[model samples]
Target: MKEQDTVDLFVIGGGVNGAGIARDAAGRGLSVILCEKDDLGEGTSSRSGKLVHGGLRYLEYYEFRLVREALIEREVLMNAAPHIIWPLRFVLPHSPDDRPAWLVRLGLFLYDHLGGRKKLPGTRTLDLQRAPEGAPILNKYSRAFEYSDCWVDDARLVVLNAIDAAARGATVLTRTPCISARRENGAWSVTTRNERTGETREFRAKVLVNAAGPWVNDVIQRVAGSTSSRNVRLVKGSHIVVPKFWEGANAYLVQNHDKRVIFINPYEGDKALIGTTDVAYEGEAGQVSADEAEIEYLMSAVNRYFKEKLRREDVLSAFSGVRPLFDDGQGNPSAVTRDYVFDIDENDGAPLLNVFGGKITTFRELAERGLGKLRTFFPEMGKDWTHSTPLPGGDMENADFESFQAKVKAEYPWMPRSLLQHYTRLYGTRLSRIVGEATSVDGLGRHFGGDLYEAEVRYLMDQEWATTAEDVLWRRTKHRLHLTEAQQAEFATWFSAEMREAA
Candidate 1:
C-alpha cells in the first residue's frame, strides 16, 4: 500500500456507531477510513424503534447511568439535527394489572429528572376520559401519563454522519467488505474487497475499530484474527407498520402482561409503527424477520389497550433487526443492557477497539468516549469538538427547523407545500443542493412516485453513496412505503438504466 493510503483509524462497520466514530475521529484530525459490506445503516440502525429516548423501561433494570446519558443526548441530537430529530410526546395508559400507579409515577419521575432537560416538556398526568389522546384507548384505561422524547429518521442519521465524516476527510467505502486485517510493524494492515466491482484495496492504519454491530464478533475472529473477553448477544427486535388508526401526533405506549413495554408510534404521516418483541435469536442477523408468533404477540398487546383492534391483514410492512448487545448473562433478551462497552485490545503497541451494544440515542457519546480510549496513541489529535458541531444538513441558524421551513417556503414559492415540506424535513438547509436551479416540478427530472423525484435520486447517488434501488428506496429514504409495487419495479429499472448509461 502507498504511504498516502495509510490512515490513523480504520473502522470496520458502517452502522451508526461506526459512522459516528469515523465522523468524530476525522473531525479531530485523524485520517480515517470507514468500510461497510452493505449500505450505511442497513443493519440495526435503520431498523430501530426510531426514538432518541432515555429508555424509561431500562429504569426497571437500574440502568440509571445509561438512561441519564441517553436522556441528555436526546436534546443534543435534536439541536444537532433539527430537521431529522424532533420532539415527540408519548402517552402511556395506566395498566393497573401490570404495575401499580405509584410505581409508574416513580419511573416517570426519574425520566423527568434524570437528565438536564432544557428544551423538552416535563411529564404530566392525563385524564384519558376527557383528553383527546384518550379517544383510542379502551374504557378500562381512564388515566394516562404523557412524557417527552424525540423521533429520529434513523437511516438518514447514519448517512448524514458518513457524509460529515467524508467532508472531514474520511474515506467512506460502501458495498465494500474488509477481507483481512492483521497487526504489522506496530500498526495495522487492512484489505477490503469491493463487492460490486470485485476490486481489492489495501490500507495501513495505526488503529482499528470494530463497530460491526451484529457482525462485531465476525470482524474480530475472522477479519482481524483477534479475540475479546466481551461477546455480543444478538437480540432480535421487530416492528410492524400499518395504516394510522388514531387521531393525534402523540404516540401510545402499552405495558404487556409479560412486563415488557410496546411502543405504538405515529409514523410516515398516514401510518402507525407498532412493535418490538424481545425474543432471543440464534439465527443469522440478516435473515431475522417478524415471525407469525411475534406478529401476533405485538398485535395482541396493542389490542389489549386500544379500541381499534389490528388484524393480520392490516399489516403493511414488517422489519426486524438484531441488537448487538454486550452479553451480560441475562436470560431474557429484553433485560440485556443497552449500554455500550469498548473492549480495547492493545497487543504489542497495536490496538483494536471493539464496540459492543450501543443504541442510536447514545452513538455520539459512544464515539466521543471511544476515541478518548485511543488518545494515548494519537496524542497530537485535536480536542473534542463534535459536541458543538452539527451534522451535515443540520447546520441551520440555532438549529431551528421551523424557522428554516419558513425560509424554504419564502425562497420557493412555486414549490408545492407537501413537496417543500418533504425536501426541507429531509434535507434541511441542504435542500438547495438537491433543488439546484429547478424552478418547477419538471426541472426535477422524472417523478418516481410520491415525492421521490429524479433530482433527489441523482443527489443520493452522487452524494450519499447510494448504488442500488434499495439503498435509495429503503435506507436513504422510505419511498418504498409510498410507491406501489409496480411503481417500485419501474423505478428500479429506471435506476439501473441510469447507472448503466452513466457508467
Candidate 2:
C-alpha cells in the first residue's frame, strides 16, 4: 500500500464484479489496485442464493439471451472452480395453482437446449408419487421436473478472484474505502483510507472502475463527485439456513402464489440454504437483514411442497443482500434484468467504468465484458484470457474435484473424513498450503470446536486478508453456524491473542 502509487487500473468495490474485473485486468498484463471498505465478497456477492443457474424463471420474461449466456457460463465457471461449483439437480414440482405443467415443461425444454449444455445432464420428468426424491413432498403433487444447475460458494468465488488478481501483480486493499477520485491531468487521482490502520494512501490510476454493487450511485455521486444518468434499482433478497430435512441429495423448487419461485437446497452438510425474496429496498445496503415476513415467506413456500414442515424454531440463521439491479423501469422487482450493464464515463480523458445488475452465475463474463469496454484506454493491454483460466485453488485436472478429493484423502490417511472434505471443498488444490506437513488431526494445530483448526485460520489470515473474527468465521468460512456460542467466543479470544502476538 505505497502512497501516491500509479497503476493502469484502480477498481473500487471488491464484490464479485470488482474482483472479477481486477483479476481479468491483472491477468491481461495490467497493473491494478482493488480497494474495498469491507472484506471481499462481504456484500451482495456473498448473499446470493448460491446458484450458478440460467435463471429458469427468466424464460417467461423472454430473457432467452440472458438465460442462454448464463447457462453457457454455468459450465465455464463449473470447470473454472469445480471445488466450489458443482452440478445440482433441482426437482421443480409442477403446481397447478401457480404454473401449468405444460408451461413449466416448455421452460425446461428451452433451458436444456439454450446453453449448449455440455457436462450436465438434461431435464427429466419424475413421478412424485413413486420417486424417492418426492418422499418428503406432499402427496398432492404427483409430478415434478428435474433439471440441472450448479451450486456455488458465492463468497469464496469472490475471494478466489481477488486472490488470482493479487497473484497476477495486482494490489488488493481490504477494509480500505476509496474516499475521493477526480480527473487529474488526463489521469484519475484516487485517495483511500484503510479503516483498520487509519492510514490514508493516494493512487494515480490511468482508469478508474466503479464496481460498487449497491453503492454504485453512491460512489459515482458522493465519492467520485461524478454523475451518471444510469441508476441502480436496489432490490433486497434474503435467505435462511435451516436443518436439511429432506432425505435425498436433490433440491426442491416450489412455485409461490405471488408467481415467485423458492429453492430449498442442501447446504453445508446438515443444513439447508433457502431463500430469496425480491423486494424493493430503500434502506442502507450494510444494514439489510432477513425480515420476519421474508423468513416466513420462504418457509411457507417450502411448506407448500414438503411434507416435513419447517417451523420458526427450525431456522438456524438468516441473511440478506441488496442487489443493485440496473433500473429498467420495470415496476415488478422480479421482472428486473439479471444481466449486467456497463456505463463508461470519460471524465475528460480518464475513464470510469460503472457496472450494474449482474448475477453470481455470470460474474466472470461480466468482468471480461467490462474490461472490453475500456480496451481503447490501454491499447497495449493483453487480450482476453479468463475464459479457460482457473481461479485460485481450482487447478484440478479438467476440474475433476472428485478425483482430486480422492487423491488428497489417500495422501492424508490420518485426517478425519469431515475435516478432509471441509479443507478440500474450501481450498481445493490449495489445501496443501494449509495442510503442509500436517499428518494427523493434531498436526492441524489447535481445534477450536467442530472442523475448524488453527492451521486453517492461519492460512486464511496469511492468504485471504482476513482481519476480523467475523470475516474468518462468517465470510471466509461458515464456522459460525457450527460452533456454539461459548466455543465461538473462545475461538475469538484465541484469535485476538494471535492477532496481538503477530502485531
RMSD of each: 1.0, 1.0
TM-score, one value per model: 0.99, 0.99
lDDT at position 57, candidate 2: 93
lDDT of each: 0.93, 0.92
Deviation in Å, model 1, residue 369 alpha carbon: 0.2
Q: For candidate 1, what is the TM-score? A: 0.99
Q: After superposition, how far is residue 494 of candidate 2 from its true place, in Å?
A: 1.4
The prediction achieving the highest lDDT against the true structure is 1
Judge candidate 2 against the unseen true structure and give its global Cα lDDT, from 0 to 1: 0.92
Tens-digit lDDT string for candidate 2 (102-187)? 89999999999999998999999999889999898899999999999999999999999999999999999999999999888989
User: What is the alpha-carbon lDDT of model 1 when measured against the actual structure?
Assistant: 0.93
- Would you list the clashing residue pairs of candidate 1? none
- As a whole number from 0 to 100, the lDDT of residue 43 in candidate 1 is 78
Please give me the total number of clashing residue pairs in predicted model 1.
Answer: 0
